[model samples]
Target chain A: MELIDNVSVAKKANVYFDGKCISHSLTLADGTKKSVGVILPSTLTFNTGAPEIMELVAGECRITLKGESEAKAYKAGESFNVPGDSSFQIEVTDTLHYVCHFG
Target chain B: MELIDNVSVAKKANVYFDGKCISHSLTLADGTKKSVGVILPSTLTFNTGAPEIMELVAGECRITLKGESEAKAYKAGESFNVPGDSSFQIEVTDTLHYVCHFG
Candidate 1:
């Protein structure tokens, strides 16, 4: 497996996607291989309409699901599979971090 | 979306596999679909020699990687893609929980 760090991304993959700055560490977009990612300390503002599933790995994460009234709070280890086609903002609370879906 | 609580698992899944209790919440065993699961608080003593990777989702977790001198400690959000072959033990400390692989 290849090792990666935020530095690698901050130097190269710090770009804006759907209006949010995303540093693509590793992405398997072959449609055959699913995508796996680790959410870092970043604030994602609604840039486009794409629903996504997020799981809490560590720390506290605040996420506002599409068509939802209240924002879902996830603790470490907890997970939420989000649907694409919604707009929301993601904020990392207290250095919140998590491993993206990869099962 | 199907909501699952520990009670549902306690009433049903509580089996030992390779010397560990695994409550399969949702699994896509099809080669086309990757398997995804959330690890609960449990101790997995090496029943056989199957290598596996464990990521810390929440709380504190103690895991021993095959052929490693020291056990790797992971916090919530951090993830590890483990190989399925090296057998090991897993124990959740302080209600430690984790969202198993799902990408």
Candidate 2:
């Protein structure tokens, strides 16, 4: 869906990589935590504490998980999984809009 | 309150000035429209079709409304208004977090 409904959104944003990445935290009705965010065209490494599902809403990116040599390209309407306590390098060719599900 | 509850948030972001400013559209249950956004440290001009109340959640900036000669400084917990069909110039010294209420 294009919209996430009935959630509480934090007014303050999570800014990272010098504002190359920006996200707003959300708490769903059942207490599920998620974030809607944007990543401008940039190559950045992100470390994860909780396993995450990066669901793309728009734009394009290439992702390389830690210890992986080959990069996988992902675009709008695609999703990628990253392991907990691991990291990934993402090269964004276009501005990326995504919802991150964390647990 | 620090959070806006029971609202629907658009997954896609509104990226402006090449990502210097970013915001997400939100719809309240009563159909009131609002946005939560971030503006990185930069000077930018914004035009308004609807009158706006920009409520600052954090950071600092100086604002000059359309046809105004003097700029006003605002910080966290402050707010500023801009009339419809007018514009404003904002010089952000620190990254800005805000909620825009439009009518």
Candidate 3:
């Protein structure tokens, strides 16, 4: 096993969308890389605004957009497709952790 | 987006083998969950002993055992099957970061 500690890896740039931090980072490689992400626990709430970024919650969390389809539970270890330009609301019955990327 | 901060999540146990800290954390759920792990930058080395835990390094890292098959490169974002009981040595030509998990 090789351990690489204390080395500086490139950090993605962060863009702000209505006071929310939208960080984006591209891999330092050249190819069709696979998508992998981890959604750690946080307390960010989404309103009727930018909606491409969907929060992945765990443990019986429900997400329902006002006047949209039925409320759906964001199951643990499962993923939800983030609508690019739709305003949606996500409510978690408990704390959550989620990490994802667009490759 | 749900940001779940400041909440105490269950952390996994740490098992040390030969002065190495193998800290682990299981999700606060119960089921046949898919595996997800992040192998951040570390400086852990492998020798002619314990070799089940393979490190995933990026950027043309070459791994060679004492006397095994021809040395192969530990390509970035690509995974190498860690021989359960074979020992190996890794040499990275540059700094790196890698994260992977088994399901």
Candidate 4:
């Protein structure tokens, strides 16, 4: 996908998950909010409030979405959607770069 | 500035600065590459190879550009530019979230 050319970033917030994951939120011009983060090598589960599109910018991970029978491997440029009110499990083999878009 | 709606992420890379900072690179659709990173509370100096616009995505930091006698405080939503081949010093009082654009 091609994003627009101009962007205004939001104030920084320090979100730490036991030193495993770190991320900050950004607000777009139209007021759309998203987060960019990095995840270290670990297994983690996340619950979402809104439907989310998780795009992998770097590294690799195996993800098991809710109601899915098996985990799927996703690398950079790949993304998965998680329904709101559901949960997903992700296993990171190395550092992972990701952007989460909530809709 | 508003970024475009779609973007393809690049593979992740683990960049560690003696545990003070970590970041990964992403490539935009136009093949423009940028980096997102977090800096811990410390003072650090960096030399740049390309002209850079450092946007503060979160937190606060003080920066001293090359040839500058006094450092300036920049909070989230602010940014500073550095000329290529020059160096700058940054003092982070809190965890700093930043994205760097190379031109």
How does chain B score by TM in each prediction? 0.52, 0.98, 0.43, 0.88
lDDT of 2 by residue, B2-57 (tens): 99999999999999999999999999999999999999999999999999999999
Using TM-score as the measure, what is the rank order of every candidate, best first?
2, 4, 1, 3
* Residue pairs with clashing backbones, model 2: none
On a 0 to 100 scale, what is the lDDT of residue B81 in model 2?
94
lDDT tens digits, residue span A54-81, model 4: 9888789999998898999998889989
Which is better, 2 or 3, measured by TM-score?
2
lDDT, candidate 3, at A63: 71
Query: DockQ of candidate 3?
Result: 0.02
In Å, residue A73's CA in model 3 sits off its true spot by 1.1
Candidate 1 vs. true structure, TM-score: 0.34
Interface RMSD score of each model: 18.0, 1.5, 15.9, 6.4
**Please, what are the lDDT tens digits per residue for candidate 3 over residues B18-48?**
2122222222123221112222223344542
Q: Which sections of candidate 4 miss by over 4 Å?
A: A1-8, A11-14, A24-33, A66-70, B1-37, B42-44, B50-84, B88-93, B98-103
Listed in order, the DockQ scores are 0.02, 0.78, 0.02, 0.17
Compute each candidate's TM-score over C-alphas.
0.34, 0.98, 0.30, 0.58
Best of the two (3, 4) by DockQ: 4
TM-score of chain B of 3: 0.43
Predicted model with the maximum lDDT: 2
Query: In candidate 2, which residue ranges exceed 4 Å CA deviation?
Result: none
Q: A1-103, model 1: which lDDT tens digit per residue?
A: 1211111111012223321222122222232212223333566754333444454534566877657777777777677766555567677664433333333
B1-103 in candidate 1: lDDT tens per residue?
1212111111112223421222222222242211122333566654333333444434566777556667766666566655554565566553333334433
Task: Classify candidate 2 by CAPRI docking class.
Answer: medium
Q: Candidate 2 overall Cα lDDT vs. reference?
A: 0.98
Task: Look at candidate 3 and tell me the lDDT of residue B35.
Answer: 19
